[model samples]
Target: MVVEEREITVGGDARPARFTSYDVEDFPVPTGREEEWRFTPLKRLKGLLKGADADGKVQIDVDGLGDGVTVTSIERDHPLVGSVLSPVERISAIAFAGFTSGTLISVAKRAVVEQPVTVTLRGEGGTAYGHLVLDVGDEASATIVLDHSGSATYAQNVEIRVGANASLTLVTVQDWARDTVHVGYHAALVGRDARFRSFTVTLGGDLVRLAPTVRYAGSGGDAELHGLVFADAGQHLEHRTLIDHETPKCRSRVAYKVALQGEGAHTVWIGDVVVRKAAEGIDTYELNRNLVLSEGARADSVPNLELETGEVEGAGHASTTGRFDDQQLFYLQSRGIPAVEARRMVVRAFFAEVIAKVPVEHLRDRLTGQIEAELEGSGV
Candidate 1:
């Protein structure tokens, strides 16, 4: 339960952190008493709260990158860096201030690309602050892959702008060293009639906390947020997400699946959706599911929905947290499948729907392998 609900202020004299503000000072440092920080374990965040420095210990490598996709670096003050999005939390503000430079990836307007843009980030051990922006131009379509690895304390802000009528599929894999700590905020701006799909697969890390927020710039935009988190013994992984239906007739759906195995494993999923009064006829739904694979593991699921209009076509939310389906497992075993193999089949089936949505084949195969490895009890 939240401590106090009446303490939040907006505008005028003193305003608490409004979801729309950009100023870092507008948001107070979370003391775990606030609604947003209640489920998060802030003590494990290292120093991202006080403004962690970017030590240049993170190395970025691009592979299979093609032309027409330009990568440019700009100073933090660049007008285009945060033009579409502003930090809504203290960690995001601190990250923007501490980052050495901002990376911008631009796709030409109306340009169609066949190859996927791939970027590999390896942390060389130290504290790092980062900023990444992906701007998909109007009527353009592309796939982006962001892979993170190695050891470090990393905090960053990611902003993605999906232009009018553009379609984008972005895959982010957090495969870090066990000692790594990552805290980042990802915000996406979806334009009119545009489609944006994001897949986040988190596998390896000592502690990983990711926040993804979405809002519509125009009507008829469709946004889908799909995430999968697999946590093994002693690993802490959390995902907090929000989708704001600000435009009429916009559609949005969010589904996050988590699997926890072994002792000391913890996973958290928080999903919130707000349909403003102006957003008439907006359709939205959010669902969070957790599967505990073993003893001494924990999964926390929360789904919140705020509707300000009664004219919406459809609006709802759902959450489910429990162990594996024993009946299904028994049926699989009775069909002559080995116990381990049967369990694997059920787990794969649980995740296959989301993984199949990945537009890239090689990337899908890679994610499948990681999931299989996790099911097989492989150590990170």
Candidate 2:
């Protein structure tokens, strides 16, 4: 279906509606005038917006493939690709046009995976384009972990399609180098009675932007999006999401938490949810909370909800940004903990609720350690 494609005002500039275009010609090079590029540091993008190619500079390595999972490296577009979502930005279109090969993952029907599929993308240097397509068979359940590290200017697209009654859990960890710049588009098509969960943790990067979109194909679909960001000195992190509720009896919940510290730290979160007139009896809500741990950090959060009809069950949005809880820190300090330790305790407690949901034990431990390290470096 063609989108309404309205433009909303942001900082006096117009922001394009969700699901704009899939063609490269439809998206032009952004000059930082568009609403999407206004918050991002386009000057630090390293010419990625001009449609740069990889030129054999980046390396993508994958490990930990569970049983009943088949992987393929296809150089051309497959039937399953582009089914759920399309490229809505210029760099994402460039990544779609200049990919060396597309990774295709297929899970067998009714197969339960014992281990999570881990894919590590190491950026040696230079610019690169890439894509990934995951097809989960009916009644199948699986977990995938996509990890990024090292230095590079990269753009890519990810599409996940779940069959009816299937379940998919995707965890993306962006642990890039302090000089890396990466942007990617991720979208999922949830089927009837299916469940989709997306968890993202952003730790290191000079500038990183992630866009995730969701659309329900049938009734009784459910989607949950959770994100964690820890930005330090001289880092810029951005995340935007779109949830399209076109079918009845579908539900979506979004929760993104972030912490900023040190000089030149910045983060942005944009949440857009649209419920069509035909989508009756739907339940959806979005929440974004930012914690400023230091003096020089900045965080921008916006949640937009558009409802065509009021026949839906419930719909709402919330956004909050503030400093640390001094009372919580005082409570910890009064309990015999040192001042620094008390601060660390408060920071950890802020993200403990989200970290505890990691189904992978070792990965959860790693995330906890990373959070603790961030707290130590915060100097708060």
Best-fitting candidate, measured by TM-score?
2
| lDDT by residue for model 1 (123-220), tens | 99989988899899999998988899999899878899999999988889999999889987889999999999999889888889898889899999
Per-residue error for 56 in candidate 2, Å, reads 4.5
TM-scores, all candidates, are 0.92, 0.93
Q: Score residue 261 of candidate 1 by CA lDDT.
A: 92
Candidate 2: residue 194 Cα off by (Å): 0.6
Clashes of each: 0, 0
* CA lDDT of each prediction against the hidden true structure: 0.84, 0.85
**273 in model 1: Cα distance from truth in Å?**
0.4
Runs in model 1 deviating more than 4 A are 1-26, 378-380
Give the top-scoring candidate (lDDT). Answer: 2
Q: Where is model 2 more than 4 Å wrong at Cα?
A: 1-19
Candidate 1 at residue 207, lDDT?
88
Model 1 lDDT, full chain set: 0.84
Q: Give the TM-score of candidate 1.
A: 0.92
